[model samples]
Target chain A: MTDIATRATRVVAATGGRRRLNGGGPRAGTIAAFLIPFFLPFVLFYLVPIGYALWQSFLVVRRTGGQYGTSYTTFGGFEQYVQVFQNNEFWSSIGRIGLFGIVQVPVMLFVALIMALLLDTPLLKIKSFFRITAFMPYAVPGVIAAIMWSFLYSPQLSPLIDLLNGIGLHPDFLGPGAVLWSAANVSTWLWTGYNMLIMFSALQAIPQELYEAAKLDGASNWAIAWKIKVPIIAPSIILTTVFSIIGTLQLYAEPAVLRQISSNISSTFTPNMLAYAVASGNNYQQAAAISVVIALITFVLSFGFMRLTSKRAGL
Target chain B: MSNQTLIRESRVSRTVVMALMFVLAIYFLLPIYFLIVAATKPQGDLASTNGLAFSHFQLFKNLGTLFSQSNGIFLQWALNSVIYAVLGAVVGTLLSALCGYALAKFTFRGREFLFSVILGGVLVPTTALALPLFLLFSATGIVNTYLAVFLPSIVSPFGVYLARIFAAAAVPEEILESARLDGAGEFRTFFSVAIKLMAPSLVTIFLFQFVAIWNNFFLPMVMLQKESLFPITLGLYEWNGQTSRVPLLQESVITGSLVSIVPVIIVFILLQRFWRTGLAAGSLK
Candidate 1:
């Protein structure tokens, strides 16, 4: 790592020297012209909206006169946040996704890690075929994947149900008890391959010399993988985990699509969906609060994971 | 004797691994296989006949109905999706490339600060912005318009991040210096020389943005109100929601879902190498 850093610095210094000899870098006008196009929309779409949401979250709606009076917004500090915290539906959604992240993230990452390790090993044949097949679902949109799986989950349509019944084992994929896991299944199917590719790429980056030493010491392939490869690829795993945590908290497309078919999924099935439902129902302030809360959770979890992993890696 | 035993052990382990992988492959392909088979079956056979088998070949009939349904709204949705995804991707890629190139090659004040701001944008979940964007757009009277979705979709922070990394890695300083020495303007040098070097990574960025826009649901769901403005995702989702009241629409929904995914799947398979490199770079970074 230090060698790479030194080489990078050397290259930068060489470029800096050349740049100075060439009458300095581009003028400020050129830089501004290039960057303004992206920053315009970025500020408009991303930064401005965040500020708007934060501002909106602090406002509350009030009926001025009677019950049927005109409704207007007033600055009510923390009122919307208090309502969100007190809302049963919001809590349920958070709890549901919390359960989802705890269970699904680990299971998906474990499966991905195993696949990555297997692909890294010499035992696998037709590696490209396996890799592509696994990664194919990542290309499928979340809505469509949920739609496709809903068919397989539907008792009226699925032949898997028929076969299972024939064997006297009836499975209810969209039952209230199982629908969350069913949604979890869709996410796992969609993301496992992508995560596997991340891990597999990291595994490929491991030095061959490190493994040669293990081999010379008579360490089995399994031992070498468990001891060396997994430890070396820990940072990659943490990265994927952070991404998965963020994805889990922002779970809307899958459950929303699945909600069409299954009554088990409520309007507030996920926090994002709940926020949307509220916003569509004309409760923009409260929706903004929910959005802020979800965003805060995502920020904390992602940054916390990064901090933990970097500390462990002694970076 | 030890060598023979080792060979035997290796054979057993290889077989186990192969079998495990084969099962996993089947698991991965099963839903897609089911969709294909279901798309080919008549409405009557969808529930009665086996899902894995074909009772009657009705793929063309389903396609016909899917296209002609609701005055060809499905096709309209498909067109809208293509326009939104393709145009957004093209514009987004160019903007990202420009900004990323400037960030990488230029020695401007507050460059790292600007890049850090963009990196912070990467962590801001877009879903959190949907409501506020809706409120803001509605206030500006742009809600329920194509611009609402298109404007937001084109501003991909992740795309900019990827482009910056790619620009830094692929475009060499010496080339830019030579281009400058040849009296080429900064924009001229970028357009003439730097873009060609960054073409592969640009394709990766384009593909990423394309998939993102195509898969986008929440933003469109909030931004657009007209059925005519819906993307395939929102369109199919609406159809899926109405399946209970209109059972016949189920088959069309299935067929439409299958139709919508084929192009994306084909793109993935054909551009497999770009995605592989993109994923590798993403993880490593």
Candidate 2:
């Protein structure tokens, strides 16, 4: 009877061991079921592609050996990178856009700041109407806005030209010298309201009590705007500046669309345009290298500007 | 300080303000006015008539011409755009919201690291990644597919970052704990409790993704070679190029351009409540 009881206890212990083996498992395996829906497509479409781009940028496509069809060649070691660096049109487009940044960033920000201040005025009536009107352009997509401006800038379509022609002056808007400013104007028109809205939202957040106190202290509108509101929204201003700078650096859609209507804009009109041109010309390696370089410069410039400006503001 | 004097001054200033507002409104609405005007005019009228004037308003005829031209390819591009934007925004916003909720509520290993990486990614421009992304997809033999464009757009670092910030503010930890204590599963809690709480932020993220995807031109241009797959922006540009030769295309292009802003305008009006408030909150943050 004792031997039989001991055998029964051992059998029960073995059953318990089997249950433990199957009951609990790693969370990673279990959680993976929930995760697959979210992570798989992202990794497949985003992470893998970005990884391949980096690898392909370093690779050289070579037609190989002495054989007619079999001569696949080697890495050629930074040769593509060197070629991109030496491409005169690519360099010129980068330079031109750099000049554009020098013009665009300050003008847009300054105008946005001024508009926000005006809208913030205590005497301003019908505030919602002005605010909506100012920000309405932001609703128009950039390409559409560009197209609309192109029409307004066109000699055939511009009412401004008709007005000028009535005054006996057929001023050239799409001319080589004027076209850059013309492009910049389109950008400003599209973006000023956007930047203003950003700044205006920040301006609205400044406590009304502070303004009431300033009024009691006999502070002029300009003084309150310059000393109080501007200083307070300095970070927001810098934020907009950084965004504008990066956006200008990556200018493509506007320029690309403009190229069709205006003959002056060549295939390599902007760095992005230049990179695209190279890719179209079957120089993918060089295009990839140029893109990487442009990306690096844009990152450095944006971050660097933020750091420098914030330091100046003593933030 | 007399009531009569104050009334007189107020009326005068109101008149001045109205005049100023009128001028500003004109400057802002002129493009739309011109597009509408141009869309109404026939090809000959577009060249001869004043850009701002309406000449017989050929609305129905232009619509007919626009659709009938090129086997209704404009409609095809419009459909393609809607597919990309709607699908990308919906999928992207969901993932972003889910990831954001987890980071906000869950205490796990490498949470901060994951967050910081996302923040860093917010600074990296989409254009910067485009070339690398293209190469990677092509290597995997997925280039020129809608999946190529749509997939990359879904992984918006900014959207995720915004979602995290919003989730932290909108969904309190105490609520989550109570749901857990009630024996609600994590998934159930997130979908039922957390999602309801995060509705406003989710809407904001969705609108941003929609507008962004709709406006996106470069990615589609790079990833798609087929004209059938082109978004309205690229499609219009192609049509515009042909307009210099095929003058009839000018009417279609103009009308299509006007019609394109309709969905966005409707989106703005319907979603303005969420957007305006979100914008205010976001800027303050």
Highest TM-score scorer: 1
Top candidate (DockQ): 1
When summed lDDT is taken over every stretch of 10 residues in candidate 2 chain A, the lowest stretch is A18-27
Mind giving the per-residue lDDT tens digits that candidate 2 earns over A81-121?
Answer: 77878888978998889888899889988978877887887
- Score candidate 1 by TM-score against the native: 0.96
**Quick one: best lDDT, which candidate?**
1
Q: Give per-residue CA lDDT, model 2, range B10-29, as digits (tens).
A: 66765765676567667787
Give the chain B TM-score for each candidate.
Answer: 0.98, 0.92
Query: Model 1 Cα displacement at B97 (Å)?
Result: 0.9
> What docking grade does candidate 1 earn?
medium
